[model samples]
Target chain A: MAFDYDKYLRPGKLPHIWCPGCGHGIAMKGLIRAIDACGLEKNNTAIVSGIGCASRLPGYVDFNTLHTAHGRAAAFATGVKMAKPEMNVIVVGGDGDGTAIGGNHFIHACRRNIDMTYVIFNNSIYGMTGGQFSPCTPTGAKASTTVYGNPDPTFDISKLAIGAGATFVARTTAFHATQIDKLIAEGIKHKGMAVIEVLDDCPTTYGRRNKFRSVVDMMKRLKDIAVPVAAASKMTAEQLEGKVLTGVLYKEEKPEYTQQYAKVIAKAQGA
Target chain B: MSSPRVEVIERYCKGCSICVEFCPTKVLEMDAFLVKVAKPEACIACMQCELRCPDFAIKVFKD
Candidate 1:
């Protein structure tokens, strides 16, 4: 069947709030395609988002959406999924929202292995809050808050998620549209906690401050810096310097939080 | 070579008119807050309208 994106898009909201040349739209399209590919019922889906440019996504899609306070999407989504185990819960937020202020929740969510998908739109900067420094902002990158350049190293979200016990973890860039769609689709279908970090561009704040000539230049940088895991495995650590790995970094199945909790409750009741 | 055609789903259009003002090619026109493809043929497939639309109401499909 031909893909019909309009069916999932909310009408009367035609123009989005993202700036021109921003990568959020690219990520959103990939997500929509993934949902379509998974054949998920619209009514069965619930998207939760925290404050950020990326968090604004749930408001645009025609689905059960919860726009929560800054850096709290995971906590809110946890409650939602636990309350309705049958609903397909997905969390959408940016680097600052998911990894900075919400860092504690992010790790707990991964460790809990909840049945949900978390899509981190990592544009590096806090795009929605006027381009502040975020936990994922690259070292030496400039932001509104980091006028002289960021001094701290950025968190490798994929590695962090895997180490924290996420059952599925992947990384992709908006430049690689097709691959992103596939990754998001797989994350949604995974029975346990899944995290997909999408490297995106924030042309207005990130690009302008970082000396990126244009949006295309920023995308090119992502493409040039990203390395496939298979290819990286063949290379030495020295050879992998300054390169980020894209594709499925890790996947392992374990009991999900909600199901395990239910079993515990059932056993206690019986006893 | 033909350019991609942009379709605006009016129902989803919040009528912010961001597309109408942002279209570098002047491809969009506003009518009572709703945007119409005034110059569909002129679209360069830059996807500015599609990307910037907060509502995701506009789609640009390559012909």
Candidate 2:
């Protein structure tokens, strides 16, 4: 039997604004499946995002959604989690929105160890904002702003989340369809802050500037460069060079912020 | 009827060709920027096209 995705999708929202070959839709499906797998009720879950191509996702899903300003999804999602600790809060945004503009908020959210899931659609460029080079854009890659090739260094988002004390961090690409949901489901099931960075493609803006002939070419490139975490350990450094690691990269247990805050409130009340 | 049902929701399809290109059994084909069931008998119902579709325009149902 086919998966009944329509159950979670908001009616009359089909035909999303993403381009024909864009991978954001793929990520959206994975998210829907993850939410279903976790058995989350639509009313009890909140999907939050900031401005970007990926941020538009919350509008299409049937959930308590917050489409906040650019670089503020994490901050808003943190607030949502703090106020409604029982609600399953999930944050979705693009690489630029999550890392570049929202870097401060992003790191702080991870540091707090809030019980929420943050899914970063790392397309490596600001697709909605005219192909501008982003912090996750690989050096030497071409973007609208980087006509001569991106000279700026890239921010490995998974590593940043892990460093900021997120309990769970995972990375996967759009080409690996099945793994996306599995990792997301795991992240949602995990106790503290979980960050799942999905390396999707922006064929219209990033691919055209970078000389990718077609969407298939871009997907094939993503397929070629990804190496699973278990396989990466056995491969030589030379063989692993230029390859992105997928699967759960980091995970740890810690005190969650909302729970700690509740304790503080209780102590203040002398209860 | 013998193999499986491959449904293409034309209203939602953007005709990206990702499904036709990824179909392992070559059971699908493009017709004027929309997907059509070209060879229904060849469909193994693997759901690759359905899973990879960026648009929710395709589905494969097997009983």
**Pairs in steric clash, model 2:** none
Q: For residues A99-154, could you state the per-residue lDDT of candidate 2 as single tens digits? A: 99999999999999999999999999999989999998999999999899999888
Which regions of candidate 2 deviate over 4 angstroms?
none
TM-scores of the candidates in the order shown:
0.84, 0.98
- Candidate 2 C-alpha error for residue B60, in Å: 0.8
Tens digits of per-residue lDDT for model 1, A1-271:
1246679988766467887657787799889989999989989999999998999999879999999989899999999998999999999999889988999999999999999999999999988778888988889999999999899988999889988889999999977777888999999999999999999888889899999986667877888989998999899989899999999999998999999999988999995
Task: Quote model 1's TM-score.
Answer: 0.84
Q: For chain B alone, what TM-score does every candidate structure achieve against the true structure?
A: 0.91, 0.92
In model 1 chain B, the worst 10-residue window by lDDT is: B48-57
Q: Kindly report which residue stretches of model 1 are placed more than 4 angstroms away from their true locations once superposed.
A: B1-63
Best by DockQ: 2
